[model samples]
Every structure is written in C-alpha cells, then in structure tokens.
Target chain A: MTMRSNRIGLLTALLLASTGMPAYAGEQAVIIDNFAFQPAQLTVDAGTTVVWTNRDDIPHTVASGDSTLRSPPLDTGDVFRFAFTQKGTYRYFCTLHPHMQGTVIVR
Target chain B: MLDVSEGRRDALKCMLWGGAGVLWTVAGGVPKSRVLAPAMADETGDGNFSFVQISDSHIGFAKSPNMDTPGTLRAAMDQVRRVRDSARLLIHTGDVSHLSHDAQFDTAAQIIGEAGLETHYVPGEHDVLVDDGKNFFARFASGAPHGGWYSFDHRGVHFIALNNVQNLKAGGLGNLGAEQLEWLERDLRGRSASTPIVVLAHVPLWTVSQEWGWGTADASLALTYLRRFGSVTVLNGHIHQVMQKVEGSVAFHTARSTAFPQPAPGAAASPGPIKDVPAGKLRSLLGVTAVRRVQASTRLAIIDTPLGG
Candidate 1:
C-alpha cells in the first residue's frame, strides 16, 4: 500500500510539470533588408517574443506612430527584441527612411 | 460775328448746322486710337507669363554627387534664365546655402543676380546654422519676422514667406510660432477671401512621414489660418523632391532641390544622396515648375518642365 501511494504522487508531479509550462519561451526573428521588412506583416500570439535583425549595411530604426516603442538604431547584424503581452496592431518604420514600413499584429 | 440769315433762310441754315454738329459730336466721342489699339496689341501679345521657384540650393555641400555645389546651382540658374520672361520674379523658398558660409551666400547672390529679377528668399535649416539664425537674419532681416517669415504683395498676388527651418523640431515640418501666427492673422485680416494666397516655407506643412524627420512639427496650426482664403497655394522645399498635395482650397507643393536628389521616401536603405544614377542624368532628375497666374482671375496654371527641356 505504501509503494502504491508513492507511485501515485510521482505520477501527479510529472503531469503538473508538463501542463504548467510557460508559453513563448523562444525569440521570433524578423529580418530587414533591401529597404523592406521581411514578412512585412507579422502575426503572433500574445506573450510571444518578436526580434528584428538588421541585415542591410545601412542603419535603421523601428519607431511607432505615437513615438512609443522605439528601438535603438540597428547597425548591420544587430538585433532588437520585444515581447508582446497585449493584443493590438503596432505599425512601425525605419526612422532613417520614413517609407520603410512594417506592421506587427499581436493576437 | 454771329451770322443771322434772313428770317426763314437763317432759321433753316441754323437747323442744318445744329444737326451736323450733333453728328460730329457722336463720331468724336469714340477715339481713333481705341479702334486701332486692340487690333495692334492683339498681334504682339503672347499673354504667356512665368516665375522661378528655387529650393534647397545647398551651395556649401561637399558631397560626391555635388562636390562643386555651386556648379549645379549655376545650372539651375541657367535653366531659370533660359525659361524666364522679362516679367518673371525669382522666389527662393529656402536653403539658399548648405553651411551658411559667407562665401556661399556671396556666390549664390552673384549667380542669382544674373537672372536680373528681384530675388526673394526665406530661411532654411542650413541658412540658420549660426546663433539661432543670426547670419541669415543679418542678411535677410528686412521685412521678415523675428525668424525670417515675411509677406509681400507682387503682381496683385499675396506671397507669404515663412521661416520653418529655425527652431524646427526633430521632424522636418515647419513651425509658425505664436508671434508669427498673430502677425499672420493681422496681416491677412484686411485682405479679401478671394485673394490668391501663396504660402512659401522651407519644410513641408503636411505629414510626410515623421520617422525620417520629413514632416513639420506644427503645421496644422498655420494651416488653420490659411483655410479662409480661396486660392491658397503652399510651396515648400526640404526633402528635395517634388511631391504635391491638394487639400480643399489649398494646394501644397514641394519643389526638388537644385543641388542633389535624395532617395524617394522609402525607396532606399536610408535617405541620402542617390549615387546610382549616371552623372549626366542628374540634371534630368531635377527640374522646375512654371506657375502662371491669370489676370483678373484667381486661377493658376502650373506647368512642370525639366531642366534640359
């Protein structure tokens, strides 16, 4: 009876460990190049991570319309990541080239 | 001596003379020159007129595309002279020089003077580089506001020259501060709503993308004052490209640079001199627009012409 009780306790602990796993633990990479953002429009779940990688030699930045959520100017091979906790559409562009535009949709 | 005819004969003669005098009076009422003048003037009158709009001359720039900046400016001047009529006036929107250098100003003045028309200038970012725009103020202070915004009447049209480069915020949009706004309100108070209003500034009034610093910080305020005018034309230069927007009664136009062409808003990796084009194509890349105003009417017809053409 004691052996059977210990077996049951160990089984329950293993189930909880797998079921309570955290979401979005890894970073999602976005590549910027040729004056455009790859996957110009991105859709991600809430609490997901988004990363921007500058593939071009020139400098670029990601600035929102309201001047909120500004990423530091990224040089070649530099990366910037932001984790989305809320659901909304965020539009951004490279400050160096006001025309280089992209949109990230957080679901 | 008054001639009196014999009773009946004198009376008849007087009546005939009176009738002939009335006929002569009627004929003489219309001048002989009036009959011939319209026909004579019609043959020689082409009735075509044009003016010059030069922006972003950037004379002191030492970049590769336009190392000898004055040379390109001279080219623009040549284009102006070749197209300009005798009645043309030169209107420089802003950025007359790149570095606000004394020699640059001097050279620019000499080159522009060659056009032989009275030149009007508004200050640009580069022009106000020294001491909150002291250098530009010293030279162009007359008839301008504290920051170099001014208005004048020419050929029955009202031209308001604004200084947007001074005290400009991060984005390139122009600002008409409180004092200037008050002055503008008063200056435009007495004018009729039908008056053709032309507002010239260095930066674009409309939002031309804020990320790249291509738009004005406080343009909506100034635009509110201009909305009452019927034919409002806003001309600007800073982004170094020809982009036009017509909103309600106002038409906003941005002229290209006489120096070098920056890349299209989002076409390049970043905004800078686009060196990919051939050297000879540079002149073709930049051009001017000729604005013609109709007499006794507020209508304006604009024709965009390339430099070589």
Candidate 2:
C-alpha cells in the first residue's frame, strides 16, 4: 500500500482501539511508484533502516544527491535497504527517474 | 513507397506468425526498409559493408520471460557471426549488463568477443548502476568525455556516440547535460550538413513513450545541433523493443533486447521482463541482425533480425 493508504489505515486502527498507539520505531519504508516516491519525505530515528521497494513496474534506483549511496537497478518487487546510522537528513532520488525524490530525516 | 508499406504490412503479419527482423537498403539518399524471413536471409544485406547493432544485453538479468540471459546473448553473438564477414563493425547501443559489476562486464565482454567484430559501446542505465559508469568506461575506450559520451568517424559516416543515460532528470528521462550538448555543438560545427550523421545512445533521443521514461529530456537541444544535417539516424536501446520514427531529416530507431522483451508502450501495467510470452515465441521477438548497401547517400537503412530463425 502507498504511504497515504497506510496512514489512513493507521488512523482507522487508532480510532478503533481508542488507546494511544505507540509510535513506530527503527524501521521505515519508501515506496517507488509512478516515477515518484510515496511520502516524498520521511523522518526516522538514527540507526534506523530505510527500505525502498519498487512498486512500479519499471526499474528504478535509489541514489544520494552527493553521490554517496546508490542501488542497482531495482526491477518490480525489488527492494533496496539502507541503514542511516547518523543523525542527519538523507536526500536521495531514483537514478533512473531523477525527478522522483525522497528524504529521510534521522533524529 | 506503397510497396514498402505493403512490405511492412506483410512483415507485421509475419510478426504475428513469429517472423522478426527488417532488411534495409539505402541508395542515392533514399532509404528502403523491408522485412524478410530468416529463410530469405540471403536477401537481407547487399552492401559494400554493413554494421551490426545489438542492444540491451542485460547480462545479470535473472528474471522471468528469460532466465538464461547469457545463453540468449551467446545466441545473439552467434547471429552476429553469421553476418560477421559482411558487417565490418558492431555497435551495441547500451545496457551491456543488468548491473555494472566487474563480473557482469567480463561476461558481456567474453560473449561479445566471440563475434570477432570490432565493437563500440555506450552506457545503458543498467550498465551505469555502479559509480556512474566508471567501470564501464574503464572497460571500453577511455577518451570519451567524463560521462562516456563521444563521437567518431567511420566509412564516410560520422557516428556520434552520446551518453544520455547519465544524470537523469525529473520524470525519469535521460539527460545529455550541458557539457555534452556544448561538445555536440562544437562537434557538429562547420561539418557539412550533408554528411550522414549516426547518433548512438542508450535511451531514445526522441520521445518514444514518456510515461516509461524512454526518452531523453535534453534530446531536443542536442537534435537542434544536427538540424542542418541532411540525414540523421538516432539509435538507442532502453525500451527493449524495435521501434522506429522518422521526423523530417532525422530517423530514430530503438533495438530489442538480447536478454528479454518488455511490453510495447503502455501495453503492460509497467515495464520489466514481460513475464509470460508464449514459451518458444519469446526468442522470435528478441534477437539482432543487420542490413546495408554501399552508396554515397545520407540515409540509414536498418535491418533488425532476431537471433533465431
């Protein structure tokens, strides 16, 4: 599901439970689709692993703007996982479709 | 022209029945392309010398539709050998490997070497998956610009090899960037517009299907540099299919893959190895062959034949 869809699901779940839900910890995912990343920007804790899954049918790659990180061509269903160990905002885009940008703010 | 249309119609009919590839002959600045069965291979090329174009050899690709990509690539090389004597040069449009691993490049080199023909290469997006094509340039000719785009002259034809795959822009479109565009302007400066200019790159310089990111974003700027040319042929191989388009003096062609075939533009949910073509017919759509004729003309005659008969 897309990030919006997941958010809606979470909201529904929280409403149904009537209890304050705990925040997600340590792991996050970015979905690649329609030449854009779902949840174009993300925030996570330091030492969290961000997994980018290609939901689109075409191939895409995750690459850092400063040329520090890159992933091989990720065909449909392929997943690229990276661990952000430091507290900084990591910006990246699909090398194949540069317009598709995303960010992960590690706090 | 009517006869050629009929020929294409017949070729399309043949394609439905599993016959693939076209034979082209150019003379007096006019190009004639025809589709011939492998049985009619003898009719394919009649030229002083012809060159081979093979594209999208995704060596590390291990997916459905095709599992043994190297085997299929080897078969493609065999087809190249079949016409090696008549074809003097082999130009691989791009995507020499699925990933730009050293071993993948080595395997591609070994298989392509079997053809025993001099080969020229450009980078495909897959081939540049690592270090922005550093490993790819290291294996091939080094003199190209930092991004591996260059041009050369051969047999009275000025072949301009471009690197559109690098530095992709928004919308997943390929980019030639300013540096390459400047070089292209200077490269074409003062050259006779009448010269037959062949531009080679990985993605289609012309917009084929924008939704799939098959086109180059800055291709129009680069093409503007060649507007004065009498005949311009742009060849590319990212979409993994044989598609042709003609715009005034420029002719654009994209080649099929030796690894696997992707859906036609907007034909599938998204583009990847088409998971399920009829088992045997898959080979019919994926292969390479060449056709040419010698003449002092500025037009390009392209012939694409599948690796299998």
Candidate 3:
C-alpha cells in the first residue's frame, strides 16, 4: 500500500501543480525533462515564487549555481518551490545532472 | 522525408542491457572478451590475479523490473563468490545506493561486505546524495582524506579511484575538477610508462551519450596522463548498462547494476531504470561478461557474473 498511497499523493500534487487552481499573481513554473530545464530562462517579479516540477522519471535537484538555493531530490512529478525575495538574476541547475540549467531574472 | 527507425542511431546499443562484471583482455591495442580465465591465469602466477568489477547496486531502488534490490545483490555476491575462490579482489564502480541514506549505505555494506573481499569503491552520483558522499567514503574510502579520490598499487597494478561525481558545473557532465586533475598529474609524475593502470570512477570517462550527461567533462585532460601508460583499463558505472570502447592503449568499460537496468544510449525518451522488463528476465538481461588479455605481464581478467542467471 505504500507504493499505491505514495502514487496517489503524488498524483494529487501533480494535479495541483498542473492545474494551478490557486495560482497567484506572482507564481511561475519550470518543468524538468530529458535532463534539461524547460524555459532555460524565466523572468519573474521580485516577490514571485517559482515552482520547479520534475516531469522526467529520474530524480533531480534544483540547486543554485552560487549556492543560494538548494532543493531536495525531487522525483517524478515532485515539485520544489522557491520565492525570489530580492531583485537580482539567479542561476540554478540540477545538482544530480548539472547540465540541466535554468535562470530566473527577477525584476 | 522518410520515416526512420531507432535501431540505426548507435550500433553499440545492440548489446544494450548488459549486467554484472565482465572479463577484459587488451591485446595489441585491441580489447577482446573471454570467459575462460585459466589461460592467462597461468601467466601472472600471483595466485588469482582476476578481480571482479561491480557497479550500480542501487540498493534503495524498489520499483519496476525488480523490486527486491538486496535479493539481486545477494545473488550477485553469490555469483562473485563462485569466482571468488580464484579472484584477487572486487572493485565497485559506484551507485551503491539509490538514495544516499545511512540505512541504504548500511544495507549495501552489510550485503557487499558478505563478499569478504577487500573491495575498492568510487562514488556514483547517487551515493553522494547524503553529506557529499560522507557515508559512502566512511564505509569504503575512509583513508582517502578529502575528496574520496585516491590511488594505490596492488600486485604491480596502479589502481586509481577518482571522484567525478563532485564539482559538476552547470551545463556540464561528470567532472574530475582541476584539483583532482592536478593531483592525478602529480600522482603519475614519477610512475613508469610501462606500468598497467586501472582507473575506477562513478561516471564513464568517455562520452557515451552527451544528451544524457553520461560522460565526464574533464576526462580528456586526465586521459593525457594515462595515454603514456602501456596498458590502461578504465572501469566506470552510473550508466546502469554495459558499454565498452578502446582507444590506443586504453580500454574503457562500464558494468551492470545489481539492482536494475537502464535503457541504452538514446534508446528511450530519457535515461532511468528500464522499468518494463519482463519479471524474471531481469537478471540475465543485466548480465554480460567482459574478458581481456594484458600483454604487459598483467594477465588480469574481470568476470561479470549475475548469479541469478
């Protein structure tokens, strides 16, 4: 039942991430697939929150290139959300597969 | 435009789902695979000079293909034990655990320790998930000092354990880092060119698949130091499948995972465990033997035996 229960929980989370039912004004999303970050660069407001969803079957981590942000290992359909509190450009990459990189330009 | 097939992309993918350790022989710059070990075992005369190379154990993995990782690893150890009587030792290429948990490491050590051979290990990206591989090095490479990268001589063979899973730059593949490279240069500065060298790292030194990040970024610089050696064998893991290539005096080989199997390079949409393999056919699909002959009086053989088969 652990696998089944976990799957159900994950499915619910995926629905929430994809549907964006409660999406606020300053929230964005980034998807990970094929060992690359979709939306290589994303521009969001200073107070906006960015949620990274891993669609790839493998696990990946959203880590700051300069060690500012670090996300736990996100499995398939898992999500990691971070809020950009300041106005600056932030670069992040997957710690597991560092080649998958993305940037967030906060205005 | 004409519709094409996926089979023609890379010819090597034909031998895709190889598992376990393998036997390798380098004769006149060409690598060959053999089964019988006694032919060259007589040349070395150092008791049993053959060692086993195991990779990608992935202990915490409990999905698809096979759910019981420990069971399969036990069977692999049994297979190693079958040849252990005539084996020099065992070398693990890495991916010892699926998630780098202390319990995962404990389970991996408890099972792999049953082999009773002084096993040499390198850290796969998976193993370093916890405390930058502190748990893994604490178990196998405690003497490595800092980076879990070290080298030693065994039976005239200079064996190097390199950590390519760390210092990985964004948009880059596995990296040896400038520090490890400098260490390697100094480590080989006073060595003889005639010596036989075996390199163990978690990631493949050669670029097996660029899109998948299956290769190392700074491997070329490290290869320059090794190119001078008369005979060099590089063993790696993290790809979860067997792939081999030979260049000049160097032969690079990747072994199978005792836990699960991954798709061939570009054979699927992405790289991960091949979850759809038929239930019982899992082990055999992951078992492929590689054999090699060394003309430098090394006479070393590696057997990749998946005991379940």
Top model number, TM-score = 3
Residue lDDT tens for model 2, A4-87: 999998888787457533244467888988667888999886667889998875578888867666887887899998888777
lDDT of 3 by residue, B1-309 (tens): 522343232111212332245443333433344432222342323353567777888778765555567766776676666666656678889988877888888998998899898889999888888677788898889889788899998777789999999878887899998889999999999899977788999899989888878899989999999988988888888877666666777777777777766777767876766766653454355333434443433322333323222
lDDT of 1 by residue, B1-309 (tens): 533334334222221111110000001111000111101222212343334577787777654454555665665565555444533567777877766678878888888788787777888767765556677777755666565778888655688987766543322345667788788888888798877777888878776656556767767878888888766777777777666566667766666676666666666655665544453454343223222222222233333223221
lDDT string, candidate 3, A59-82, tens digits: 789898778888888877889999
DockQ rank, highest first?
Answer: 3, 2, 1
Sorted by lDDT (best first), the order is 3, 2, 1
Q: Which residue runs does candidate 3 get wrong by more than 4 Å?
A: A1-26, A38-41, A76-78, B1-19, B23-48, B278-309
Chain B TM-score per candidate, please: 0.74, 0.81, 0.81
Q: List candidate 1 stretches off by more than 4 Å.
A: A1-107, B1-49, B170-172, B279-309
Instruction: Report the TM-score of candidate 2, chain B only.
Output: 0.81
Query: Measured against the native two-chain assembly using Cα atoms, what DockQ does each of the candidate structures obtain, in the order listed?
Result: 0.06, 0.31, 0.41
In order of appearance, the predictions have TM-scores of 0.58, 0.75, 0.78
Q: Under CAPRI classification, how is model 3 graded?
A: acceptable
lDDT of 1 by residue, A34-67 (tens): 6678888898767778899988644466768676
Model 1 residue A62 distance off true place after TM-score fit, in angstroms: 21
Question: How much is B147 displaced in model 3, in angstroms?
Answer: 1.3
Off by over 4 Å in 2: A1-24, A31-48, A53-59, A64-91, A99-107, B1-26, B29-46, B279-309
Tell me the interface RMSD of every candidate, in Å: 7.6, 3.6, 1.8
